[model samples]
Target: MKSTQLTSTVHLDYGLDTLFGRITKSAECQVGLEQVEHDPTRFALRVQPPIPQDLEQAKTVLVKVDGRRLNGIIRHTERLEDQSLKLEVEPE
Candidate 1:
């Protein structure tokens, strides 16, 4: 499946420095993470398996991410060596 990029932004309770420190630590895990790109306005996350295998768990988890509330459920499958998937983002 081919996937397109969808985007949005969110706010974090933690300070930028602290938040990035924590995220950098978390990125050490080689499960679903692909890359983390930071920009002036927002953070771009490239992840695999765009749709979490468990929809309920994913929905609940995503709802709690940096106060994000996804607008829709989208599956973006990418045609690459890793076959990445980009999912829905909230709080635009």
Candidate 2:
């Protein structure tokens, strides 16, 4: 038996539902965020404080691993359970 890593793009959702924990994300899935900076000199000197991780939105892209270039994958915004959507990859 041979072991190989795969990669590909997955169609997923990071919609509002995820923000409320209504949806789940997968271990393979990753989250994207934007860093915001606040001026302390302002009257309300406050910042969001760099939060390591914040459930924001979901995204799908081509993932390459080992020697596989997978395509047509899907995932969620948050991890509700251990499940992922992958396409049937056939050897050419």
Candidate 3:
């Protein structure tokens, strides 16, 4: 499989609820999509680390793929021995 190297940004939303309701905590990281699977309905992005530390607390993750913005949640994340991160995302 061929992978596309592109500049992608990861948006992480921290769901923090306060007396005022949910507090919006967000962080953005400039990363690369190493192994990408694009389908008619969804995209599976294998993010090249090192992923932002803030992502550990992220409830929602949004990625900018191509010229389109795709929103998804982080289904799984693994830390490789090489210190890289592999993320399984399902587009919503």
RMSD of each: 12.9, 18.6, 4.3
- Candidate 3 lDDT score at position 17: 42
TM-score of 2: 0.22
Model 1, 1-92: lDDT tens per residue? 22224333222121112433522111111122222233232222334434333331222112223334423222233434665433332224
- Candidate 3 local lDDT, 26-46, one digit each (tens): 666554454444544434455
Ranking by TM-score: 3, 1, 2
The model with the greatest TM-score is: 3
lDDT of 3: 0.55
Tens-place lDDT per residue, model 2, 4-82, is 2222322222222444555443333322221122422211101121211432332322333334343222232223233
**Span of 10 residues, lowest total lDDT, candidate 1:** 22-31
Winning candidate number (lDDT): 3
| Model 1 per-residue lDDT at 34 | 22
lDDT of 2: 0.27
lDDT of each: 0.29, 0.27, 0.55
Error of 3 at 58 (Å): 2.7
Please state the error at residue 74 of candidate 2 in Å: 1.7
Q: C-alpha displacement of 43 in model 3, angstroms?
A: 3.4
